[model samples]
Target chain A: MSTSITLLIPLLLGIGGFIVATSRARRFSDVGSGKMHSLPKYHGYLVALSIIVPAYLIIFLWLFFEQSVLRGVIVNALPDALTNGATPAQVSLLISQVQQAASGATFGNPDPAIVEVAGRLREAVVFSRWALPLVIVLVGLATAAVLVSRIAKRFRARNYSEAIMRGLLIFCATLSILATLGILLSLLFEGLQFFSRVSPIEFFFGTRWDPQIAIRPDQIGSSGAFGAIPVFMGTLTIAFTALFVAIPVGIFAAIYMAEFASPHVRGVVKPLIELLAGIPTIVYGFFAVLVISPFIREWLGSIGIAVSPTAAIVPGLVMGVMLIPFISSLSDDAITAVPQSLKDGSLGLGANRAETVTKVLLPAALPGIVGGVLLATTRAIGETMIVVMAAGLTANMTVNPLQGVTTVTVQIVALLTGDTEFDNPKTLAAFGLGLTLFLATLLLNLVAIQIVKRFREQYD
Target chain B: MMENVSFATAGAHARAPEMPVKMFGRKVEVFYGQKQALHGVDLEIPERQVTALIGPSGCGKSTFLRCLNRMNDTVAIARVVGDIRLDGEDIYDKSIDVVELRARVGMVFQKPNPFPKSIFENVAYGPRIHGLFKNKAHLQEIVETSLKRAGLFEEVKDRLDEPGTGLSGGQQQRLCIARAIAVSPEVILMDEPCSALDPIATATVEELIDELKQNYTIVIVTHSMQQAARVSQRTAMFHLGRIVEVGPTEKMFSNPDDKRTQDYITGRFG
Candidate 1:
């Protein structure tokens, strides 16, 4: 039978089971004076689920293990002369040829032993597909019929259904956690591989970052230094410059919006400012390269200072503009959360509006404002598309914003772009960089959380 | 330094002999948007005395007291009509700066709202903003004196640098009173200041209010008639956006002229 027809079998059983369960419940009600413990619909759902869930599980687990089990049995049955000394790769290739032969693809002249095995493989696949749905139908119908026979008024169908639902929700939550753990562990293992090739001390503190590897035995003058100081310095300079532009502007805008603007103006203006965050980063990168770099270069050239078009400031300024909405939105919430009685106290004491804001509201909102600024700094450090496009890949260690620099994310992208061998130290270094960057950001976030917690406890 | 009034002569105010009026209101009315919150009412607050406004909830007593210092100006839709004078000067005139008016007429809120700062800073906030001191030493002197006057210095003197919010409920209310007195305002208004406290804290604040009556003309809005009788020398009863009666605290509590005031104070009906 076809797979769709096999799948429809359980669906039809579920419909038939619903009718049987509901009719049985109604029939049992007529024979007894006792009331039903649950509504008839719950009994119908229980019967239907008993049919579909077990049938689907049988089909799923059979499909998961069918191919590997078949492959292993066929490979073991092959002639020992061809398989005794073959490497794992050759064995894999040989298995594919046998499968292709069974599918009638023209690959090579088939040995007689291989031809026999391919024929057996075709028959086994045909038998397996048909056999699975037969067992599924029998098992599913039995479960549904049994569930209908056992459907009493006291069966807790709703509890069972809700427990299943809760289980599904937990499964979904664990899936995401598993995905994150998988990525982190992969980065850790690959970083260990890279460290085996190059010392970790040199990778962290060395000033040179030449990731070249010699191809020939006699090749000379490719040291492959892998010093990450210049890259770290570049990341810091761009992030600091971004903060220099973002923190003051974002905080001031937030203060004005929360404290000064009337409700009507604030409603219109706040969403407009938050709209900056909704724009895609690639579009911002395009604008940075096309607009801001030229503007900065021309303005600086008039002052007799030669600067590169791809200077770090171009990306840093653009990223800062991108970050303004984050800081402003969070800080606005923080400032607005302050109790109004404090303002009344200040004003009743003859303090002016400016004094009330500076002396009462700002100090009360400091911890949350610091939280906003720290979050914006993390985004600045991890920003990639703008840095990759506008901040050039030259890892210059200079503090001047006019010089070109590259961040860790930018280098990670550059390192992973092309088809490259994973065994080489140069390719492995990306994972090392990724792990280091993740750890650094994690440390920063922990410290920020501590500060915010301490400050909040002090005031509130 | 000043002397306290003896309780032996407290009943003298209940008689027909007239005392001088400090702030006078003639035909005062208040409206919030289209809704009238205060009727056309005439009343007088005596000089250097505690006048308690007693009424049930939503009687407009708080509204009438807020009109004394133009605090109603903060509500955008609120409108006041008629003349209310402070020391015989019209306070609602356009030339009267509201900040200076508030400086002369300080207020303590229903809830203890101390700024998130040290106890010393909480008291010194008024003097710092007004530039009332010649130096740091003078400012410290003013803070200590205000705290002492508010009866808070004995409890919080050792932890002057600690946050005022960390203090107990009654201590925080006393700190707020010190905050108000630090600026040396002539008249102080309190709106249900002891409502958010326990019985012990309420008794302490009532005692403090009576002592504060020595130097400041105080107008307090209260829900408890017993509290008004305990601390106030003069009492005014408000009901349904109008002042029902005004007289000495003893006469108002013992034998009110108006049926509404008599019902409210005698626990007949509010």
Candidate 2:
């Protein structure tokens, strides 16, 4: 059987189960429609779930255990001399290569004995793939047919169907929550491993961050320190600069759109600002590196102020421009949500448009506007591509925007991108930086939500 | 009662009617887009008297009230055609200042819309803008007197620094009234001032309105006939953008001259 045909086994079983259950449900209901409690589709779904859910569970179990069992047998059959002194990761890599060689694909370090064992494993896998899916399909369809044949005029198919549906929805909800918990647990385990190697204090507080590990034990002057302060400081400086640029422009644009501009002008300007947001950050990064930075460098040269070619200011400026649409769109919605009667009250008091906007409208929209700025702050902090391309990877601890800096995310990306050993502190330090970045953004988002909630209460 | 109208007529007969009119509107017509909303409205609003305009929905009663203070100019598509005179000077004249005109003639809306500010600031906004107060104490006095006149002083006296939006709907409406009165305008226009308020609050505002007419010319647009009859000496009924009947409140309700006005007041047709 083809690979796709094998995968189609569960799909066909599910469809057959649905068809049989629905037809039986209809026949049962015909005896007395009032007696049946739930819909026909519910019965179909119940039978389908019973057929596929358990069958897939068994299939997954079998696939997992069978692969391990077969791999163990092949490992045992390997020559005693070859298996000695190999780590678990290296052994797994060797097994993968052998399996590839047996399947008529090129693999590293070809060995005749391993090649022979790989051929046997390949043949077994091909046979199992052909026979296993056929057995599953036949079992699924037969079970569904037998269940449908047992349904009688007195059978509570509808109730049974509803119970199945409720279970299925609950199962889906639980599955998502469990998946989230599983991810968090995996991150925790990795972070714990990172913490064991580098103390949490050194990771968080010690200023000089240098993540370079020696591959060989004989190498001299090897040092791998993961102090995250410089990275965090760089992130804060860039993010603050971006906010300084984005908040005023975005808020003023939003106020002009909401209060001052004519509908015609607003209609034209709103989409253009949104278009600025739609342009990808990578494009902005490109503009920052090739055009903006060069121009800024030349301008600084003319003014007699020395600036690095890849200064943080160019990246901050480009990121701020990228964030303008995000802030403006949110602020516009918040300003527009302010009640019209408030504006009228201020105007009725003989206050001009400017005074009414400043004293009444802006104050009412303050929380929402601040929420938008906070959201933009998080976005700027978590941004990777702009800082990676525009801001140079030298971690400089200075407030000057005209200096090279490296953010945590950019460091994390650089650490893991090249040929990295899994056990080395150099590569594992990325996970530590990632955790800190995640926590910082998470805190920022919570603050944004709180501000939005306070804004809502003021109006509602 | 109808006897009150005759009593005023008798008083006018004895006094030689020597006092000149404070404001006059001539042939006022308002159009929203292509639709004419107010058709040839002409009236003389006497100073320090409450005039109530009563009509069903879409009768241009609110439109006429907005036109008195040139609030209609804010709407991009709305056009006002007529002459409005304040103290014998045409308000729509080329040289006339709209800001001064609006300061002289303050307004109140149907919904109580307090600024997102302290209670004191809400009342102080108008006075501060018009330069009606010279110092802090004078401003405080104006705020206190306006709040007292609006009957909101006792309720909000302790928490003047609290946001005005924290007040109840009725209290907020009175706060808006105090805000209007703080500027010391000669005229105060209200558009359906009690529509969103409860009965008790409506009664309170009605009492306040009766008292306010002693000092300021009050023009109010309302849908409630009883409210108009209770607080207004003169009532104007509008039908389909036209003033169907306008006369003394007692006469207009008890014996309406126009058929449309009679039908409207009798609850037969709107």
Candidate 3:
């Protein structure tokens, strides 16, 4: 019933009802000796909203059930011999075939029982598809007429209109909250299944992280220890190294741009800095692997410092370059937002511009700058493409930036990229790693926000 | 304490007239980009006296104020051509160091702009940059004396380590004053320093400025005619980019030589 009219009839009727309601309200107000509460358009919108919302909801609800009811009738008609060997997925497929065949969609070989059931299912679906839309149209028109009829000289259409607007706004707001909850729930359930096979304690603290477990029970190479400590440490090392490279350079550049750079110099340099940010991270990763790594290795050899060809510094350096624009742009904005009077005060006191920046501008802009750096740090931590391509995928627990290392994100990708049975703990461990990565980034973000908030509170 | 105070007071007056003009500007004109902002203006700022420039909006009073120490040099498009002398030496001379000039001629702006730093650090910043003190104790003394002179020491003494931005608007302005004084500049340029302050804060700042003139040559630009009258010894009224009248504050406010100055003072035209 809901599907037959291609969903346009009810929509048009709803819009028409809205127009009539508003026009009628306007006419009533004109005849009476009173001020019209809301604009005619707003009143019309409110009537339209009422007509569309309920009928749309009813149509959605009917469509959601209509499939299940039709599928059930077809499923019941299938032979027991066919059903015994079939999985739930196959049964659904068979039901779909019956549905299509009934609709005259040239289905392949059908069972006699399916033929009978399919005929009945087709009649019910066709009838409902047509009848349901007509009913909704009638319901919408009747609801709109009723609402418009209530409009009179004293009607508070404006207040009702405002309420509807608020509800619409709230409906939009729920999307993000629901998406976050959905992700957390799916991860939690998957993690639970993985934990059932491998104890949570061993997964967290075991020293070995060899995850070559076979999908079949008889198969074996490495049973795989899923200790996450090394992966976590690697992420930290990369993030910290990247931040060390980025923060000082980014901050100084920001200060120079905001406080000291001449307009001519700023005009030339600011866009170049932003251009660095615009380059794709994947491209940066490619550069790290092909160009930066070899150059760093050469430099290290000259200095008599031996480093693996796949040095962590390779990816870290590229990540830092990627982050430079983020930090500089954000810090520049923060510094610029600091009142000019503060600079004047410092300069008036006979302080040099450098002193003024260090003492006044930097401190004033510290909270905002810190927020930017933290955001960049999180980006570096969860970064995958650069680390995967340049930083070796061997999980080596070392603090040296010159050493090759792999982060949790890379390990998770490696574990889950191949096809494997769901029961295998090796594959399941990827979910656990993902959860940890999510939590660490989330925690850092929460703490950063709190610090920024407290800093803002000081000035406010 | 009272005896010493009186003796200092008497000594201050005796030394006041003995000091010669520290800064002099002749036939000075300032241009921002292609637009001329300051017309030919001649003025002698005594070594230790409050000289105020007063005018309506866009009269170039602030531009004239910035010209004292070459603060206009910070703006790339701003051009100044003419002789500005510090102690009879032309400041516009090629050998001049702007950093040193700015150090000698500190400025306070209309709004309080305390750095987002500890109150102690804010005051120490100027001195530290100039290498004014030998050690921490000497630095502390400079901070204390500067704050005391700005009339902020007593209120902020216990909370010296707190962020200067945490202070009230009045205290922050005074803190800025203290920060400026910490560098021990010969002259102070204030551009409408009290415009952002409430009446009480304005009064406090005005009192501080009055006391400060004994040690520092002061040039203040103000839009408020009443503020110029209260704080200045010599008043210069500017119209457009030109100086309309220059004389003792008393004569300028009571009986101006220029009709425009007179009209501006009477609130007839701005």
- Candidates, DockQ: 0.68, 0.66, 0.54
Q: Name model 1 segments beyond 4 Å from true.
A: A1-87, A90-165, A449-460, B1-19, B25-34, B73-82
Q: Which candidate is the best by TM-score?
A: 3
What's the iRMSD of model 2? Answer: 1.0
The 0-to-1 C-alpha lDDT of every candidate, in the order given, reads: 0.86, 0.84, 0.81
Return the candidate ranking by DockQ, descending: 1, 2, 3
- Between prediction 2 and prediction 3, which has the larger DockQ? 2
Q: Write the per-residue lDDT of candidate 3 for residues A152-254, one digit (tens) a residue.
A: 6667777887887788789779988999889988888888898898888887877667777755678856778787777777788888888888998899889
lDDT of 3 by residue, B56-159 (tens): 89998898888887877767799998899999888889898877888889988877877777999989988887899999999999999999999999999999
**Model 2, span A22-127: residue lDDT tens:** 8777776364456666456666776787778767766777677877877886787677777799998978887887778777897566888778878778777777
Cα DockQ of the candidate 3 complex: 0.54
Local accuracy of candidate 1 as per-residue lDDT tens digits, A136-162: 878978888787788786777667766
Off by over 4 Å in 3: A1-7, A29-34, A76-90, A96-132, A214-217, A264-268, A293-310, A454-460, B1-19
**In model 2, which residue pairs have backbone atoms overlapping below 3 Å?**
none
